[model samples]
Target: MKNKYLTLLFGLLLAASSCNDWLNVDSKTILTDEDISQYPELLETQFLSSYDDLRGCIQAIGDGAFSYRQHHLSSFTDDAANNTPWDAGVMSINISPGRVFASIFSQSKGEILTPVWPYKEINKVNKFILQNKDSENSEVQSLVGEAYFIRAYMYFEMVKRYGGVPLYSGSLDHINSINDRATEEASWDYICNCLDSAIVLLPETQKVATEDRDRANRYTALALKSRAMLYAGTIAKYGKVINNGLQGVRADAARDYLIKAADAASQIIQENKYSLSSEFGDLFNGKDEDNNEIIFRFSNVAKTGRQVFHDYWNMPYRVKKAGYTAFMSPVLDIVEQFEKLDGTIQPLDYSAKFSDPADFFAGRDKRLDATIIYPGGEFMGERYSIYRETRVKTASGTKVYAYSNQEDWTNADKVPGHESYMMSGYDGIFPNTSGGGFTNYGFYLKKTLYAVKQLEDYLSAENEQDAVIIRYGEVILNYAEAAIELATSYGETKYLAEAQTAFDQLRDIHGGLPSKTMTIDVVRHERRIDLLYEGFRYWDLKRWRIGTEMHNKQFDALHPILNIDETQSPTAIYYTIERVSAPDYLITRTKWFQERDYYCPVPTDQSPGITQNDGWN
Candidate 1:
């Protein structure tokens, strides 16, 4: 998968002469400027080239890179959980390593710019559209809309990663050598307006072509707008309290944007085409392409398909894949956040006595069971055996059945192997038993593992699962969160009930249990569990801007850290005990040093003249 994308990036870099050179070498009648003018298909091909970047959209922004580390850094600034160097490892004190996140710091030059190929490709298509405006293909309008959406999306990613990024809406020429940086406000306005403009021209519905599934539609474009506006509104309004580094948007403007976002999302929901997946598990199981929850997805099919690199990042070490398993191991703090099955926050107060898995779910949210895998349960139609193996002795020595990895297990190096000496606290054991002691986090992911076979062939891009980007559930939560925050801020208690109503709709999808009072805290906690690994928690903390205190004090205080040796596979050695509470490290208040963490430092290398966002350097 990485190789394919590198090839695409290579093509984007050599796009000018590669095609012409290949055709010339073949002695074929190469389509020149005049030839392409006669054959309109040439223009269409040029326009279609933009889709390559879109097809790699998962790589472009969907990876856990942003959602987990970059965004979660905000949480570190906020008081959500502890921010260890191990989290992003290299960027511990905000001094990022050169090779790792070259673009993150100004040190590495242009290495960290948001994947530039897509923008360049989109620019090419937009230029093509403008140039061939006279061509009466009739299909060109939709293409223009798609181009708009793609460009808007590209810019949106750039804005999120780096607050005040250089905005390039049109084709860049050789003469346009100066690197321009737009104000954070201007960038947000441009992004939102661009998406709206794209939405204006797009079709309300299209013939569900396989190709078109990836292309921007009216709802998809609108969804992008909703997401952008929601972030913009929140940052602009909350930046003062959350992160002073942010240039907050006007509250009224933010509110207006939120309403627009809600309306756009409501249009998708009211239109009745998409809905919640009947089974929660089916959503990630890879068979539910028809699952209404997936409003917009980067569609991947067999062989040449999208490899969910994000999933690989946090996968459990017991389920091994790749040559290593460093990425995707769930942070210890995140593991404790899941509610019991009955809908109560997994108590972090360690003094509590309950240790049984089933008892853990008592009075907790049902969504917890839906999102995370508990100790012993049926996941993906297979019974998971989580009990620790015990050796029974009779006379001489005891015979024990311990979990052993097959010699060919790919993630062996990520473990405590004799050859590689790093202590990877994978599964249940901490690597480097004598030195580093224990790993900061304890849990691995079980959410998206299709099967053991799938784990073995992990690197194969054949995993065609459609990850849900925007779902009705999220929309409901978004509406509820915004309404609650706005209502609270505006001193109007009326919207609180509306927020509760939104919460009820989400609960109704699972099973209309009962009504619960809603608060920003309640909604935020619910979002953490509901959206567990769908990749939102870090960003949520960032926008709220309290990650540091959250990271430093919260989970460590709550969850008990047991010292386990790197003697064997975690799946085989330790008993999958019931959930337990941690100590008292959690900070109830949202107050913390959030401003510095709100926006990521623009990779110092991209624009050397621009100062690093305050407090980061």
Candidate 2:
């Protein structure tokens, strides 16, 4: 196996180095550079390999602060609570003030906290672009366009995390000659320019194969531009420039960037190439891959062994065969963000008692059902029973009892009189129980979890749900946001009508709720709900300059308590909701997001003469 791999690597190196040189060899493993170059189709084999690194940007599981790793971005924000007690880095370690202050942002060494890994991936993309940009073959030109999109996407990811990262236009020849960090404005400009080039060279769609739908097209580049420019525009409008523009954009440039974002999104909408999926849940349940809403997705086909473990880590406890489940528990703070069917925003009435706990979530936006699993919610054909405790009516008053484990319900010493009665639900939120398969926040994330029963084994990683990178729903929201920002922030009302139309389409068509007046706040709320668990919440808060307000506070969760009526014939049950801090132990301290956190601290020691973002030093 070692010799076979070595020969394959040697053949690839020779083919890439010298396309004309031929070596006469009889071994089937030895294919000379001249032999492989004869087939233009074989070039695709090399071009497709670049996506391995690009896919890392959206990988569901890994170790990193940048992408959706074990600590998903949603956990770091107010959107969700992470239940992994063994790994408290997301709450206790990663968000610490000392950790951020002492962070080493070298482009080469240190932990995976910084966006250093993307640069290594970018080098491969740059080399591909330099070699294939001028190819006469149209197929190869489209591949080159994809290369540009990959580079732009990586830079956008970097700039959002650490403003004004070092931009490499081509492959680096030496490790010592790294360029100085570009200004934040210049970095965004470079990203937009790359997308523009991609738009010009890419075809509207790949007609060769059905699987090519996952590949980048003209609309895919535009979708990214629309999203990226909105981030730049928000930073310019809300954040302040510092360190001679290395950290923030100019305030005056906000309107232009927003207009560019609106224009790019408008083109995608007007082209009529995509539409919202009829069923919102079908988009992520692996039931509808042909859905037109997905502009670009990371395809995870089970037959090919390129799959994800979303179901293994996120399915409800009753359905899971192993321990790793409910890794991301949706906090009540975000669950209430989903509006009612009538479009009214009402906070859940925790003070009110109810006959059924699921009634607390009644008449809410349909997307809530698709996105989260609450008490009495059905997932994978199993109804969830998420009560935390039981309250029994006694001669004196109501007696309260809590079960520590699943077996305590049947143990006489644990509950005594409740031995005949089920003390807690099978999926109960028990206290003092740490780790996965337990719901710390009394809810489980249903979005992105594959719904197939055959893939329910938590020990297996063979779940086949493609990660949607860029979808039309996000584009609609982006268009609405940029247009509304233009009208409200700059007094430019010409785009207001179109913005309202786009906003209403998303709400009425996908959310199944009425649309409200278009305001920056309304658009933001809709974006949060529509794009929840898609890994956009953290950056959205930072770019909107609301991280300090949203963080540095304890997020709340719902505790469902079942009230038993023994006097009734069949013993009726009622529920009461109590609000408490989510994962009180793991989230020991309030999550803090300082102003300096808007842009990560870059290391000046490794790169000489490079200016650090203000407040880091």
Candidate 3:
């Protein structure tokens, strides 16, 4: 039976890439164990074929090839807004028949971002682990461990969305049965157990230059376990459960999961492998200047690397450098979360604080500058001046009255009489176009964007930035969060202080901000901003049961409008950050989530008899 299924697994893997580039190079040979052993390199090829399926880091930004491709997960949250109908169904939580499965299909037609059956990868990984568990080869054991890690990672992806998925640990000639849903408890247990097995089998790290460092090691499994357990704990404690036992974790086990989360994090923390750093911004910029900070990065290096079309989608609408549209825009709700330089949580009092709109940037978190591109902000050493050079004809030989109210509109171009700009900003009216300059909200993104010298043509052409899956900053924060939860449950102050120290490390480095008064909420807020676009917000909100409160409510697009019509402002030209109407493309409709909305609707086309999540039925 094992031999028959091994042959099927090999054939399925080869055939899975039938439509892809994998078949173009490899020989179409029916492999027996004998044939594979004779050509040892074929085994390596088989192993590598596993990663090719990932293509790159998971991006639901609609590019595809990432798992489950729920672009709406990020878009629907308050943190981001997409200016296209592609994700409207996602944002509104209103899944119509036409767009019911549109989330996965939104990618290029027939482009499979996630595997048709994740079981295919699971089967391949299972066979590899079975073959390797007894092998004395340390190198081969590491490969085996990675296989375990890969399986765990893949299963967690499904478990996160589908709640619980069918379990498959061994070879199969065919999956003839329904392979019914395991309880959410069983699913998380399976995932964590897989990681534990992986940790025991793998080394601390593999330092050889020839080997890919991106492969899973001891810390990789633990980091994922920590994160996964944290999710389970949050969901069990804060979310709702159903009669089917498919959607929610048991509340009784919630604290235990949280404790396990802290323990998993503590293992990594005690190892002293990595930590937060001053050059934290460099980690996101693709330079990898501070390598120690990243625990396990999704490599997008040379031939093996995955290229993300970031600038193609996220480039500022105003910039004519790239032809791609500004796909996703940041929301005012998230922008306001960045704390003041003094570490105080003061909402940007648009009327009072921004008498001059550009003063909005003053004394803000340094991370705000690192992450967002605001008006009057400079990039690549050049200030973004949207003002054009064209002149208006006048009686005095084109006495060029600056068409912009930017200089004279509010007397913003100076500190009253100084040459420097007091409100170094625009008149708030840039021509809105489909191609680039129109912003749904007033802000632009900078964290995902890495500026290169004019010497390189690749910045606009291709993308290969390292997708940091786990970093030390997150580890510290995770530990901080878990510790805070533990403290809350047990009435301990040490854990609170510990979380405070962890947060203050980041706050101090980014801006010499004050120490945090550690609570789970404060720890989570730090995570929201610190791990901004790395795709954590949606689940975080969902798990906290706040999605219905924060996300289901009507949100505003803050327009920093030039209101010369009003005497309400002392300065006739002072900007008003009005809570203006959301753009038509922005899905501003309030979300309506029933108790069942707590879980994602399973894509029914994948299989028959697969139970629908809570409310979907």
Number of the top-ranking candidate, with TM-score as the measure = 2
Give the CA lDDT, 0 to 100, for residue 40 in model 3: 46
TM-scores of the candidates are 0.71, 0.89, 0.80
Clashes of each: 47, 1, 5
Please provide the root mean square deviation of candidate 2 (C-alpha atoms, Å). 5.2
Candidate topping lDDT: 2
- Per-residue lDDT of 1-617 in model 3, one digit per residue for the tens? 44654565576456543222211222222344564555544555567666654432244334234423223244556777664444432333443221222222232335332224455556667767776577665666777788888888877777776687788786543454434888888999899889988989878876453343466778888888888888888888876667477788898778778777777887887788877666655676666633777776555545355555444456553443543355556777778888887777777766653434557667887777777666556655655432212222223443222223322433444332223333323412332334243455666666755554432333433445655667777777777887887678755444555556667787677555777777777888888888887667766776787766653555556655433322233324334455665655444333344444456666564456888776666
Which ten contiguous residues of candidate 3 have the minimum total lDDT? 18-27
Model 1: ten consecutive residues of lowest lDDT? 20-29
Question: In candidate 3, which residue pairs get closer than 3 Å at backbone N, Cα or C atoms, i.e. clash?
Answer: 65-113, 317-436, 317-437, 318-436, 318-437
Candidate 3 matches the true fold with a TM-score of 0.80
lDDT of 2 by residue, 434-492 (tens): 45476878888888777755553433555667777789999999999999999988987
State, as a TM-score between 0 and 1, how close model 2 is to the true structure: 0.89
lDDT of 1 at 264: 66
The lDDT values for all models are: 0.49, 0.73, 0.60
